[model samples]
Target: MPRTDAGVELAGVSVRYGSAKQPVTVLDSVDLRVGAGEFVVLVGPSGCGKTTLLRVIAGFARPDSGSALVGGAAPRPGRGAGVVFQQPRLFPWRTVGGNLGFALARHGVPRSQRPGRIAELLERVGLPGMAGRRTWELSGGQQQRVALARALAAEPGLLLMDEPFSALDALTRERLQEEVRSLAGRLGTTVVFVTHSVEEAVLLGSRVLVMAAGPGRVVEDLPVPLPRDPGTGVPELRASPEFARLRGHLTEALRPA
Candidate 1:
């Protein structure tokens, strides 16, 4: 999928929950802009509304005040963006190909084209020939790969992920992080990723937004200085002095004041 000029915008966006007598603000007057094909990560403590902000962009949640837009229009769910959740959320009864085919169908892909499309999606996610396997038959990492493949089945311009690799083991998490970063760059997909790990944020994000709780807001927005070359492997990058310095900087910014 070649890159498209799909971007995200939020202006004075606010979200609240709870009773009328005592509403709790999950997001407070948040403003953000994500350009086409950029990778942005949201990092914050538990109550900072990172997921809520994502939902607003995904068109799954509406803001109580202000506005949110994707591709220069009010966001509509399942339109121009694909989302990968923290869980694989695959159907146990569906084969890997079947799962991706479902997404293609929802995206209005021709029925006859689905097989080729599913195969391509699986191959892109590093699961080339396992589409026939049931979702339950795969390991956790494999399942997550299928989830990612499903998300990409639509060839969406915008990809939204909420800590999609957090459940995997360390080795698996790192491997997936590398794959996702490379894939997004290669496809030129705009991405908004949410995570609590500062390392993960630094590794995957071109720009990182640090949020704070108690009426969630962005406290810091920092652009990553690392190279995005696919040839620069994650291990090599992580070992660099620049990477270490940036990680320390973000760590300090995340500290409670």
Candidate 2:
């Protein structure tokens, strides 16, 4: 089992939209905690405030109430939290190397150390070379890998990802999922990921949290038994009786009696 010692915690968090004229509650008193080196997945129907919760953790949006803490401290915006979204959001004009180099430069890395650090990150994410290639030239999966490498370059204490693999094809998505899981373990970073797929949640999450639709709250929080190793073969796990048991449990929890 993976260590659950480090991670981000959310307490009584809620997000509301509209004034007295029209109030829309997106999240309601949701509380969640992701352990260190653990990968936790958020899964629900569309418009379930999944992305909103991720944003709150990333410090991109403030919750209407409660607090989001990274490693027990109030989250500091754009500081130690690294985020990767559905879109790669790379700079079209900059080469792959440039994109990473820019991130390293922002952290005030000296020029002498930039090359080695950039190469290290690239290798870490399985990108290897192709540093000088244009971002647009890479496939969707490759681009996302670069984006992830860029995120890791910051040496963030926590990583927040919002439906990052949802945009790719099945094979690419599965491959990236395996790669991301491995990278997170090796890097020892806590990851709070949001997705709509139950299989994905089971495959990648150390713990899976199911959210209710209207006012998104954690309706179910269950730990996944499957190991994170790629050789574990998530598809086979899905076909197992245990997988069916847990999947049905999550489905029932999400729907209620």
Candidate 3:
């Protein structure tokens, strides 16, 4: 039974596209449940349908069979789940504040409070006083930070991210990963993040689910076996023995089965 306390749940969930006669299954019989405040990372090789699983939970894709639910029921689009894509996806015409304000407004935040909320969100994402900056003026990493802030501005119970930091440079990617991990912990935000990097998964996830290819199904779901170092701790985390072990296991799991 899916737990009532689970923030996100999927039971025997599968998805397919195209005509029925020649249907292609992207996700296959995936069973998962994430409790509130848990950061769950989904990692797999290319074409493993990692992003598709996220889409299902984000209410953007219907499963061909079984169920996907957020907060104990089917998620409603733009409601229970906040989604962040591979690209920043911020409107070029909108200022950083405008982008976040749009999400807050859509979520019924008062117009009078939007400015303070936008500032708070920008500060949360490490972009203090940056609301006036246009999207184009920010770096790739900065734009992605804005995207993250916009998603959080909705105050969704769950956040679904599809490789949001993949396009960034290695250093920037590391910075944002730590930022997200710490911020999620601070805000008690439940996150489902997709990534190809084993180190990233180990570093960010409370539990990491490794999926298989073809009709994607989870091959391994392992709890990250390290104490979270909340302050300036990722470097120490990456150097730890548990990190090495999990990274090795995940790397092996991603190989052809």
How much lDDT does each candidate structure score?
A: 0.93, 0.83, 0.87
Candidate whose TM-score is highest: 1
Candidate 1 per-residue lDDT, tens place, 48-104, comes to: 999999999999999999999998999989888989999999999889888988888
Between which residue pairs do clashes occur in model 3?
A: none
Error of 3 at 229 (Å): 4.1
Q: What TM-score goes with each of the models? A: 0.98, 0.92, 0.96
lDDT score, candidate 3, position 112: 98
Candidate 2, residues 1-257, lDDT tens digits: the string is 22334478888999998896898999999988777777888988888899989888877789889988876777766677778989999999999999999998887889899889888888988888878899989999999999998888778868889889888999999889888887777767788888878778877788999888888889878988876665676577778887888778777776644
Error of 3 at 226 (Å): 1.0
For residue 215, give model 2's deviation from the true position in Å.
Answer: 1.1
Better of 1 and 2 by TM-score: 1
Ranking by lDDT: 1, 3, 2
lDDT per residue for candidate 3 within 198-242, as digits (tens), equals 889999999999898988999888998687657648889888888
The better candidate by lDDT, 1 or 2, is 1
Cα misplacement distance, residue 154 of candidate 1 (Å) = 0.8
In angstroms, give how far residue 102 of model 3 lies from its true place: 1.1
